[model samples]
Target: MTRFIEIRNGRVVTPSCVIEDGRVVIAGERIVRIDRAAPPSTRSETVVDADGRVVMPGLVDLHGDDIEEQFAPRSGAETDPTTALATADRMNVLHGVTTKFHALAFEESPEDGRNLENAARLARAVDRGAGALGDNRVHARCELADASADAVAALIEEVDVDLVSVMHHAPGGGQYDAESFERHYVEDRNWPAEAARSAAEERSGMDDASQGQRIDRIGELARRVGVPLASHDDKGRDDVETMAAHGAAISEYPLTLDAARRAKALGLATVMGAPNLVRGGSLWDNLSARKAIEAGVLDALCSDYHPASLLAAPFVDTGESLSTRVNRVTRNPADIAGLPDRGRIEVGARADLVIVDPSPTPTVERAFVAGSEVIRASAGSGAAPELPARSRTR
Candidate 1:
């Protein structure tokens, strides 16, 4: 007498195409059956009438540092790791993210948090809070210019991070020039003018020689841990090549089109922020994610800082099939991040799924994680749903 959840009358987006008026059956932690027509009547099953909504695989967000923002919303605001992560979990689950790689930055920021000490603390928090809502994992954004690369390496060993990305947030290279770097801290992040200028000067003065050594050390550690290594904000072909040489299988947020193309040519998956695509451009005036998609250089989309952007990105109708667009936020990222179990909505895949009502905009009606009802919402009128609005995701 096994029990299962049967969802009928939904537009199921599969690996190849969308099945209109499809029925998906989930038993235990796996999707058991899927068809255009319902199977035999099972008295043991709980039926959820989707009422002509869209059922897609849950989003796999590979690089969202929203947890960091949640922990410390403003400059002085400080919430504990557990509480902040719990808040982030509910937010991510509500937005259709079944798996979240909590990208925590390990760098020397002007802020009190976001340094090596605090980032490690946050990583521990993430490790402790795994599955607090969704399949939460850590994605370490290791800064190449950090004073102690050893400490950064130690953080990776401390927590079993799903992914590791090396970055150099300096004025001379990567995502910023000297002026833009200062402008970013001042105008964008709202840092004081003098402080931003000082930080910019300090970063620009970082030794490039040390950066090479840091890359080698951290890259070797990542290899030993068998975690996927990524390079962040690649500016050009040379940057892509260099990081690739040091075991960067993924190139995230390539600042220029040429860099993204180079990453693709070098067999590195390129990921851009969904907010970049949805908001029409980059905040840094860097590479355009829409153009990257047009050129066929982009492989995946991440939430970056905004969790809501991930769910709505694939639904913006970018000339690609709905399946194709959906995969950009789902299957594509899960595959890149070495998570092969839970991205697709196939029969054997893990039941990490989302039901969306796409009217004025896309809204996640219900979500499941590992066959668990993380979110339960009524599609049409009152249906006596079981879960609360802030339920977790698969």
Candidate 2:
């Protein structure tokens, strides 16, 4: 935290607007100065020429499925925690994500490589690996179907987290109807058609009262831990209201416009996956993120499962100002996460920023976290890959 860095000749995205060809000065970990005119070259500061790049606040991603994927790049294959974090941290910094919340889903989906033990290991890795290139925090995504309230609390005591979310991933429940739920198991998870169908039918008959009790207990635990609580894949206004009554401060991925509107009405921050905006719509066809943005119901965008999408969303021409879109990934999410010091290009804010090359598809040219240059793109080191172009992205 004892460094000084200077970046000049950049299109700096400020809180309210873009400052064309501006300069930002960082001292230690906070932004010290910002101006349109160039400051004279100095000896104490390491100066970087932006070369007409876009300079903006580093992203504050609330959810991404990266750590698990990094820890197990291949199915049935695993790596050590340190190696996994090193890879995830590198990928995050290269994509302009300075503060990333590893969404650790506590489910028994072994086919997709998630279990209670695996979640704990990943949480411990992030907990132990402090001072990574970018900030890493845990988001405990507890599936009420598989985890008891006591088990969820026990895991929270084992390792601290940045936020918590509760959900039920069953047919006729969160994120799915009977057909889509069964289809997801069959198509995505490779479950047998009959088994998936049978599972869906079984889930539909579960006791709602029992599920509500689990939600209350988890909500209490989140309140005790003093982190933001979120409800995931909400499908209706009633779902939004029910979660909000339990102190849920954020609503992640509301499946309908009515649900999003209700979340916003209930003063819950509404988050949608960035990939939905990038790929034109939701992959599962719940609610269109672009539609949410246009309806002015969405509060922020999460990476969901794609870190690249967060970097790409702010510049995707959503008919909003660049500042507005940038804040959706930066300021809004940071605010929701109770991080007031980062996610803005303002004096006295943490100097977490990224400089991007946006012409041929956005690429992180340089990234700074808390006044430290964690990543700087160079030809000698090989160019970072461009944003992926595919139909089924994320």
Against the reference, the lDDT scores of all candidates come to 0.85, 0.84
What TM-score do all the candidates reach, one by one?
Answer: 0.94, 0.93
Put down candidate 1 lDDT per residue, 1-394, tens digits, no spaces.
5568888889999988999999888888889898985664565267887889899999999999899888888887878988888889888988899898999888877554567777878888888774475888888888876754676667766677778888887787887878888778787677888988877776677676878888988787778789899999899999999999998999999999999999999999999999999999998889988999999999999999999999989888789999999999999999998878878989889999999988878888888888877877665667744454333333
Question: Candidate 1's error at 388, in angstroms?
Answer: 6.4
Model 1: clashing residue pairs?
Answer: 369-394
| Candidate 2 global CA lDDT score | 0.84
lDDT of 1: 0.85
Any runs in candidate 1 off by more than 4 Å, and if so which? Answer: 379-394
For model 2, the run of ten residues with the poorest summed lDDT: 385-394
Put down candidate 2 lDDT per residue, 242-276, tens digits, no spaces.
99988999999999999999999989999999999
Which portions of model 2 show Cα errors greater than 4 Å?
Answer: 41-43, 192-202, 379-394
